[model samples]
Target chain A: MEKIKIEICVGTTCFVMGASSIQALEFEIPEDLIGKIEVTESRCMEFCKDHKDGHHKGPFVKINGEVMADATYDKVLDKVRAIIKKKEEN
Target chain B: MKEELFIEIGSAYTNKAGQDICGDTIHFKKIEDEMRTITVLSDGLGSGVKANILANMTSHMALKFVESNMDLLRSSEVMMDALPICQIRKISYSTFTIVDSNINGKTKIIEMDNPPFVFIRNQKEQVIKNRTLTSPKWSERSLHISQITTLLDDRIIFFSDGITQAGIGTKKYPLGWRREGCKKFTLSLIKKHPNISAHDLANEIIEEAKRKEPNNISGDDMSCAVVYFRKPRKLLLLSGPPYDMNKDKEYAEMVSLYQGKTAICGGTTANIIERELCLDCEIDKTSFDKKIPCASIMEGVDLVTEGILTLTEVYRLLKHNIELKNDNAATRLTKLLINSDNIDFVIGTQINNAHQDPNLPVELEIRRNIIKKIVRILKENYLKEITIKYI
Candidate 1:
């Protein structure tokens, strides 16, 4: 199975805004997407706290290093689905 | 340290005044991490407020001394010398009964100025041989102190003088309720409800003591504490649908490996389990109420019920002890939980959007919140080991 690496920032700022939900992605994955995704929590994505431009804020998820800003439930879901769908098509 | 123990303490005291305060004090503390349990019940010298204070002080000191690994009899001696003596009776102000038990089934009971403790094994009173030790302060004052290795299903009941002294001047019995009477009543009750929980049994005995009272006015403060040794009955509860259908096999395997009773909650989750395990579920047509859905039965599953509503009802019944018949799945589930010693909840993370339907009369709650609330209540009130694992 081809795996899509999913990175989630679990730093203090990100966690307060709801990044812990990202860690539960393993339980939230759909049937077709279960084993095909490799989820990891990065201490800091350098997007939430230290980003100078500030386009990407806290509670962020990065699929293969592509940052998703304000990674709410729907936002994270969309990013994960995109990666999993791409792998399925391949 | 891992052995299961059930401790129940109940008290009934009649005050000279109509106030609710009973002079007798019952205190129980369990250091689960340390595998030690201390139960102290003290009856003060007189019936009212002064007696209450003395009882409280004795029990408080008794627990502290026992926790520090002081010898039981020696500790009693210290307590006797420390407390103020009664001018007329020439004895300690408060009389106490202490039951200190360790995880290895070693139980030490020390009683000073109270009645002898009763040991019941298999519905019959077991005669316990205790050594009479004299108080250091007063050589004439001797008390009963016993040590025993508790066997599984053994029950030790200790009470204040008020219990055996019930109905002293009544026509029913010119003499008070004696040790023999107490034993007979306890044996009869145990015979009728053999598997009664500790809380229920303690309550029954205390209520009986009150019944034996003349005109419901107890002569003294009454308290009863019981310790029952039994195997832990574990229950596994599965609720909600798995987020990934592919993980159903893993979930089913986990359920199959559990050593205790299995309960499947939610229609979708049950169907998923049934599909993965290739089991058949026969739905019960009988409805307990309209609020909750009908129950179903799978071959190996102990309980099967509809999702959120049944769970909500179970949570409500546990939180607020309402009267409900056990004919339906929800109430039966409640009964099973109350009787069990340990419970593990395997919850699925998939949100049921349908539960949030606008037409529903009750407020919609997510499964995680419901599970958390139920776990808290079961742990705090029922004293059960509850663990939650997400799928």
Candidate 2:
């Protein structure tokens, strides 16, 4: 199966804004999703620091090119599941 | 249970007999009668036999002095003078950090020039608070005395550069354990096995550090003195004005006399303080917690930044005090500052028109306030009587 790419921002700004937990997202995803999702740790996507909607919408994790805010465990998990399900359908 | 304080020490170094004959030595003694636990960590120059001798000698000398009930300055001086200097090396120095307090469950730390000690409680690590202790005759290098009383159940960690130098993750710098990694590692251990012994815990940390380093460098001989108290330690705070050149000259000369440990924070300031103090210093970019103005003087150790040098010594002093620990936190912080016998009279300086508030820039001020809260808590619980002199 083609892996659904997941990128995590490990920059200072993201790191300070709870990216510490984002770094652990790979482990939080279920075992079956591990094969479907490729969690890539990146050094400063730079875009995470770009202000959006008048808020510091950073510390983000991009799943299959879809950007998500407050990229917490549950939220990221949901995104990972939807991507995997869609990949299976395709 | 006997309800008596018991201490078991396990020390190893590069010496001939797996003993620290002349390296950094941490001495712990429990005075059951006084309910006081005396813990001392002293760092001598170099490693191996000679260093072992110096460190061992320091520990012994400090023990004798403390046991004799002599004043802290007198004790440190006696130990410094007693060191056997090598004719060829021409340098045999040792820095000290000592804690003495009654067990009514109160713990006070009397620190000279040693690395900042950390206390672990509720699985979180916090550096012990200290103040500057000065003696006129020995105040070069700023002989400082810091007394801190803390509640028991808090585990106080005293280490030489050896432990801190343990590399971790990709960044191969000492103090590189990366607070989060170290914190997580420590917390995980306790959480996994609540009954783990302190000895085991210490070994785990050392082993982990060794494993993470690429060269598997045993690194410097590692040693840590950890005191796990069951209750809060009492405290006394004492501080005086910043360094007064007129009066500080003698103190500076005194610090010059002893071989003590020195820690410098921020990049550029570490360079200058190392040169001025004639002591080996390690600079850490990620070391200082960004909350307060950076503290330049810790225990007997001085911290400075590039900005301070350009601005002026007085500005550095004011900015530093404001940033690192707040003016009010001086109470408990005085306990940690008493690391050097040479540090006397804190000389605080800053350029300010009466009309202007000398507080740091807004962002830096926020950091300062966070540090302030921590310092305030330390002062409320421990420390007393530290003076501030603005130049």
Please provide TM-scores, in order, for all candidate models, with all chains considered together: 0.64, 0.42
Candidate 2 chain B weakest ten by summed lDDT: B232-241
lDDT of 2 by residue, B1-391 (tens): 4343322222232222244453677666655456555767788777777776787788777766776688776776666667887777775577776766565555666666665666667666765555665666555544545444555345666666665555634465645554355456767887787544445566676676566565776556666665554321222111211134354333333334534333221222233334455655432223222222223333355343222211222223333443334331121233233222122222222221111223312212222233334343323222212222232
Mind giving the per-residue lDDT tens digits that candidate 1 earns over A1-90? 667777765433454456656666745686756687887655334453245565445577877777777787667767768766776798
Q: Scoring only the second chain, what is candidate 2's TM-score?
A: 0.50
lDDT of 1 by residue, B14-62 (tens): 4543546677887777767777677888988876776787788889999
TM-score of chain A of each: 0.77, 0.77
Extract clashing residue pairs from model 1: B266-B307
**DockQ of each model vs. true complex:** 0.01, 0.02
The C-alpha RMSD of each candidate to the native structure, in angstroms, is 14.1, 23.2
Give the residue spans of candidate 1 off by over 4 A: A1-90, B1-25, B44-61, B70-94, B132-143, B188-196, B214-222, B253-258, B277-300, B306-331, B354-365
Model 1, residue B231: displacement in angstroms? 2.3
Error of 2 at B139 (Å): 3.9
Q: What lDDT score belongs to each candidate, Candidate 1 first?
A: 0.74, 0.50
Assess the local accuracy of residue B106 in candidate 1 as a C-alpha lDDT between 0 and 100. Answer: 89
